[model samples]
Target: MSGMQDRSWWGREARATVALAYPLVLTNLAQALIPATDVVLLGWAGPKVLAAGSLGVNLYNACMIFGVGVMIAASPMMARALGQRAHNVRDVRRTVRQSLWAAVALVIPIWLLLWHSEGILLLFRQEPELAKQASHLIRPMMFGMLPLFVYQVLKSFVSALERPGWAFAAGAFAVFSNAILNYALIFGKFGLPALGLYGAGLGSTISNSVMAVGLAIVVTRHRHFRRYYLFGNFWRPDWARFAQVWRLGLPIAVTLGMEVTIFNAAVFLMGMIGEPELAAHAVAIQIASLCFMVPLGIGQATTVRVGLAYGRHDRVGVGRAGWAAFGVTMVFMVCSASLMLLAPRFLVGLFLDVHTPANAHVIDLAVAFLTVAALFQLVDGAQAVGAGMLRGIHDTAVPMLFAALGYWVIGFGTAILFAFHLGWGGIGVWVGLAAGLAAAAVLMMTRWMRREKLGLI
Candidate 1:
C-alpha cells in the first residue's frame, strides 16, 4: 500500500475504535463512581468504618474482577461468531447462554469462600474486629456477585453486537440508584435505618440486580436483540461451549487476578510502612485506576474489532484493529501522563483536603507517588491494550504466563526488594509497579508484533 493509503486506513480504524470505545469508557466510569461514592460515605461513617469498608471492598473487587474475566470470554467469542457470518444467532445465543452458566458455576464456590471471608482475613493476621466488620460488608456484597456477573455477560453481549449504549444507560442508572440507596440506608435518611457499612453493601447489591434485569429486559424486548431468543430454553445446557469458556477464561481470570492482586498487595505493604504512606498509596492508585479505565475501555473495543477480523480470517484487518488500538492508547496515555506530571498536587487535592495542615505529609507522599505513577502510565496502557490485542486472536495461555512472570516474579519481587531491603519505602513500591508494567508491555507487544510468525493470526 502507498503511504497515503496506509495512513488513511489506520486513521479510519482509529476513528472506528474510538466510536466503539467511548460509551464503554463512560460505562466503566459510571461503574467506578459507585465505589467512589461508597468510600465517601464510609469516610463520613467513621475511620474504623472506612478501614473495614476498604478491606471488604478490596476483597470483593478481587473476586469480582476474576469472575468478570470469565464472563468477558463471551465478548470475543460472540464477535468472532458474528464476523464469520452476520447472523450466527445460534452460536451467539449459545455463547451467551453458557457464559451465564459459567457465571453460576464460578460463583457458587466463590460464595462459599467469601462466606468465610472473616476467617480468611483472620488467617492473614488482620484485626479480629476489622475482619468481623468487613464480613458484614462482604456477606451483603457477595449477594451482588452473581447479579454483577450476569450484568457482565449481558454487557459482553452488547459490546460484541456493537450496541453498547444501552449498557452504559443501565450503568448510569445503577450508579445513581446506588448513591441514593447508600445515602438513605447509611445515615438513616429517608426512612431507612442507619446500617452503616452493611447499608453500603446492601445498596450496591440492589443496584447490581436492577442493572442486570434492566439489560435483560432490553435484550428481550428490543428489536435489535430480540431475534436471538436469548432466554428461550434457558434451562438447556451446552457443555461444549461451557468448556470453551473455561478454557479461555481461566487464563484471563488468572491474568487479571495477578494484575489486581499485585495492587492489593501494594496496599498491604503500605500498611506496614505507615498510615501516611498507605493513605497516599490509596489516593495515587485510585487516580491511576480512573485514568486506566480509558485504555481499558479501548482495549475491550480492540478485542471485538480484532476478533471480528480474525473470525473473517482477514489477517490485515486484524493487524489494523490491533495497531489502531495501540496507537490510540499511546496517545491517550501520553496525555494522561502529562496531566499527572504537571499537576500532581492538583490531582491529589481532588482526593484529600490539601489545605489542611494535618494532611500535608500525606499529600506530599501522594504527589510523589503520582510522579512515579506518571512514569508507568504509558507502559500500563500499553500492556492492557496489548493483552486485548492478543485476546482478539484467541491467544491467552501464554499471555497469562507472561502476566504472572512480569507482574509477580519481576514486579512484586522488585517491590519487596526496593520497599524493604533497599529502604526506598513507598516510592520503591511504585518503582516495582513501573517495572512490572514495563516488562508486561514489552512482552505482550512483542508477541503481538510477531503474530504472523507465531501462527496467532
Candidate 2:
C-alpha cells in the first residue's frame, strides 16, 4: 500500500505538478504577507515609519535570501533521493538537524555585525530619524533568524517529500498570526500595550517562532516523519551529511547573495536620489515582489519535479517539467504585469495613503517605477523558473556563475551607467535590472535545453 501510494504520487505529470505548485504558491504568497503586514501596520504610524520599515525589511531580506538559497539546495537533493527510492527518513531528519546548525553558524556573525547597523545605514546617508527607527526594528528582528531558518528547513523537507501542503499551512498560520499580532500590538488593542514600530518587529519575531515550533511539532507527529525520528537522541549531528549539504549549498549561497547585493545597491542608489524616490522604489519593489511570488512557487515546483525526473533517469520528463513551469510562470507574469501597469495608482494606493500630504510624491514615483516594473516581470519570471529547473539537475556551480555575472557585472554595471552617467535616475536603474534578468533568462534556458539534449538533466 505504501509503495502504491508513493508511485501514484509521482506518476502523473500534470496532477503532481499542480499538487507541488499550488502549495508552494500559497506558501510564497503567505511569506510575502509577513512584510506586507508589517508595512500596513507601520504605514498607519506615518511615512517615516513606513520608510523605516521598508529599509529594515530590505536589509533583513538581503541577509535571509542567501539563507533561503542554502536551504533550497536541500530540496533537490532530497527529492532526487526520494525519487530513486533510496532516501531514509532518518537521513532526512539528520539533514534537517545539520541545516539548523549551519543556520546558527551563519546567523551569529551576521547578528553581531548588524549590531552597528546605524553605521551601515549612514553609507546611504538616509534621514537620521528614519535610520534610527530602522535600526530599532532590525535589532529585534535578528533574534528570529534561527527560528526562520528552522521553518525554512522544515519547509524544504516537506517539499522534498512531495507534500508541499504542509509548508503552505505553516506559512498561512504564520501570516494570520502576524496580521492579528500586528493589529493588537501596533495599535495597543485588546489590552496590549502598543509597541509601535518595535511592536511590528516583535510581531514578526513571535510569528516566526510559532511557525518554527508548530512545523517541528506537526512534522514530528506525522507518520512519514515518525519513521525517521530517533527515539532517544534528537540532538546528534551527522558530520558527513552536513558536509554533503554544504557542498551542494555553497554555490547557491554565493549566487543568492550576489543577486541580492545588486538589488540592495540599486536601493542605495535610489536613496541617494532623494526620500520620495526611495519611498517610490519601495512601493514598486513591493508590487514587484507580489508578482514574483508566482514564479518563485513555480520554480520551487520545477525543482522538485526536475529532481525527481533526474533521479528516475527520465530525461524527457525533466525537459517537460522545465518547459511547463517556465510557460506557466510566463503566463502568470504577463497577467500580473498588465494589471499593475493598467492601474498603478490604485495598486500603490492600496498600501500607501496616496492622498496624504507626505505620500503624494511617493505615489507619483511609485507609478513611474511600476511602469518600468511591468516590462521586467516576464524576464524575471523566466530566469527564476530556469534557475529552478537547473537546481533539479544538481547543476549549481554554473548557474551560480551565471547569476553573478547577470546581476553584478551586467545588472549593476548598467544601472550605474544609467543612474549616474546617463542621468536616468530610478527608471534607468530598473531598466538595467530588466536587461540583466532578460540576459539570465535567455542564458539559463539555453543552458538547460542544451544539457537536456546531452542527457545531463
Model 1 lDDT, full chain set: 0.89
lDDT of 2 by residue, 355-412 (tens): 7887888888889989988998899998888989899998888888898778888888
Which 10-residue span in candidate 1 carries the lowest summed lDDT?
A: 43-52
Instruction: List, residue by residue over 217-249, the lDDT tens digit for candidate 1.
Output: 999999999999998888898899999999998
What lDDT would candidate 2 get against the real structure?
0.82
- Residue 389, candidate 2: Cα error in Å is 0.5
Relative to the unseen true structure, what is the C-alpha lDDT of residue 127 in candidate 2, on a scale of 0 to 100? 74
lDDT of 1 at 131: 73
Number of backbone collisions per candidate, in order?
0, 0
* TM of each candidate vs. truth: 0.96, 0.93
